[model samples]
Target chain A: MNRLLFALPVLVLLIIGGFFYRGLDLDPSAVPSAMIDRPVPDFALPALHPGKKGLSTADFGGQPKMLNVFASWCGPCRVEHPIIMRLAARADVEVLALSYKDDPQASRAWLAELGDPYRQIGVDRDGRVAIDWGVYGVPETYLVDAGGRIRYRHVGPLTAAVVAEEILPRWQALQQANQ
Target chain B: MPAAKLHAKLAVVVLIFVIGVSGGSPALAVRPDERLSDPALEARARNLSQELRCLVCQNQSIDDSDADLARDLRLVLRERLQAGDDDRAALAYIAARYGDYVLLSPPIKASTLILWTGPGVILLLGFGGIIWVRRRRPVTALPPLSAAEQARIKSLTAADQGPQ
Candidate 1:
């Protein structure tokens, strides 16, 4: 009993240290989106391409799709652009794009250079639409389910690893549940 | 001068500076263009912005941050107020999208009760620990001095007294 009493403080210290150690590995910058499981906030943006139809909440029904929020000026978006292209090519999920706070001309030129993989592009010129979407930064992605509810949101760039790991598992799970 | 003295001087300078600047007009980040036409509406907007976190900066409130998203949030708050939404409705609109994390001081709720009470709980635990340790000391105290040990002590004191 005395030995146990002597070890009690050490045990408490170890537990507290364990919590702090776990905290060190956490990314403080990744603010989890409050919009998850909620319906895509209502928004309609102009077409990034002159003739193509723009994007909106109405565009999200009948299938699960990925909405990539990116800007021409954002560096990480370019890094993730190829992965988006690959995803679009697989034809498993409809990958859409929101051009956040970007100039249309610049966005068009970027798409021409990078090879546009988006099914439809929405232009959020002043970034007001992004506010409703709770976008704190560029290059966020939201995976919306068939029922127009946002299932998951990734705050930073989407990578091939992320697509394979995070996106695929959730996508598969969502598909099974739907069926 | 020694390092400790130098640090003391610097501390005094900082203290004086803080005291000197304590009562000045606060520097608001709200740009003139973002302000509503009506003062009452603008004041309400300002109050709401103070409660909303600048998600980009995370630590600074939207009213105090100069980040682009902070500016956009300020505009959204003003728009809501101009449209005649009450303070509760205005805050709820922003909170709906950004989550409770966006609120600088989130209201106490089922999810937030722990956050609000954690410090106090730790304080109570600390007091309990102190009391337990204090009380346990008596139970685990050194055994009473033996009779032989006491006699040896008495002889030692007698010898010392004689020498003195």
Candidate 2:
């Protein structure tokens, strides 16, 4: 009986440790994109500015685009916004923005304070669109081809290195392929 | 009872209760500065942060911490909010920087099956042990008390009654 008591705690510790260790091997940040090489999901939302329309998946059908998911409330969004604005000037590619779980007024104000680089902004109020995009967090950017298929994903703030090294080349290749 | 005495007794009782409640939460090491003024936002931050483990602190969350890394995490959350990011986005940003280990509530996956199911598995094993113990033990009814044992019991009862 006394031996069993000692063994019981060890057994419990082993079980808990096993679970903890199991989690260490898998990267939860890398969920498989549902839009992988497939046409993007479709939806049009109220535009950020008056008298202008926002995006649906069809808008991206003929051009390679970078879809950046952001919110006015997220901090890293500020860190990554500048790079996105810089990418916007590259006439070869279009930048589509998704405003997630944010008030429209706040989003518009945020863009005004920073700079609006998005060719079109889609509002995802409930984050349903974010989920559909297989997004786990904010400031995630996806690269999509003209076919609306997702080509690449960046999990955090877009750095200069990532843009210069990876995104630009991929965008060029896709642009050339369409021509 | 005198009013002064009654007040003193109440004070003692209250002190004991305070100690009891505070002592139960020894693992709650969160500092005052780590908290927010808004109850709802603070609760949301706490709930979300607790789901994320601190990378430097290992298995502990910012909710259970007083370290510099925890302070940085708190700052990260506030920045996300000020930038117009929602709770999920802020958490994801941190997760991206530190990896999923930064999450206290791990995502559900084939690899995490043990984490999700461990408690029930342990309870089942415990119950199975109890059943095994019961089955292995012999059922022995107490033999009826012998006549001598009854006489000794009667004397003991009589001896006790003599004092009355």
Candidate 3:
């Protein structure tokens, strides 16, 4: 009994140590999105490009697509530009972009310089629309199913590995479900 | 100095340290334009902002964060207030969009019971363990000293007292 009493503190310490050890491997910055499996919030904004129709929540219902929140000033958005371009090229899914809290002229110049990859670009000058979408920061991507429900959310820059492993598989699943 | 006076001085120093550490630094990040004209509504906005977490900063309340997202949240709160939504309604609108994680004080529910009560439960268990250990400890009674040993001890005490 006394021996067990002596061992209790050590056991508790080991349990706490195990939890901390597991926490070390997890990404502290990755906050779980609350928008998953919910309908995309209502928003109507002007187009970033001249002489084009503005994007809205109504635009999403007809197909499975991806909505990317990005800004001209956001470095991580620049990092994921190529991947977004590649995703745009795919026929299975449509890619839409929201220029979050960015100057429309700057956003246009950015797209022109980087190569335009978005099917429709919405200008969120004041970031009010982005707030409705529960955007913490720019460079977040949401996968919307054909029913206009948010299926998955990816925070931070999209890497080639994430595209192949996480995004592609999820997109495929959503596509199959639609079929 | 006397011991009581020294203790009072020490307490005063500690009080000063605490006041210094927790003084009204007003780390408010609310921009001038964000403030409502009506003092009563502005006060409500400030209180509401303090309860909402700044998603970008993660650790800071929107009232205390300079992050763009935090600023956006503050603006939204004010907009909601201006639109005639009450405090609970305004908060609910944000919470529906951002989830419960955005609230500084989470509501009490089955899901959060452990988070709320874990510390208190741990403290009770600690006190209980201390009491249990003390109760279980056997106090051994000392054997009576021999007359010879008592005499020797008395002699040693006398010699030590003489030197003192």
The CAPRI quality class of candidate 1 comes to: medium
lDDT of 1 by residue, A55-151 (tens): 9989996778889998989999999999888888875777888999998999999999999999999999999998888888989988888898999
Residue-level lDDT tens digits of model 3 in B113-160:
999999999999999988987888867899999999999999999988
User: What ranges in model 3 sit over 4 Å off?
Assistant: B1-28, B138-140, B162-164
* Reference-based lDDT, each prediction: 0.89, 0.77, 0.90
Query: Which candidate leads in DockQ?
Result: 1
Cα distance off (Å), candidate 1, residue B29:
2.0
Off by over 4 Å in 2: A1-32, B1-164
Instruction: Report the number of the highest-TM-score candidate.
Output: 3
Ranking by DockQ: 1, 3, 2
Candidate 2 lDDT, A1-179, residue by residue in tens: 86987798799899989989999997754544445675666566667677776767777767788889999998999998999999997777689889987898999999999999988898887665565565656788988887778787887788899899988888898888878
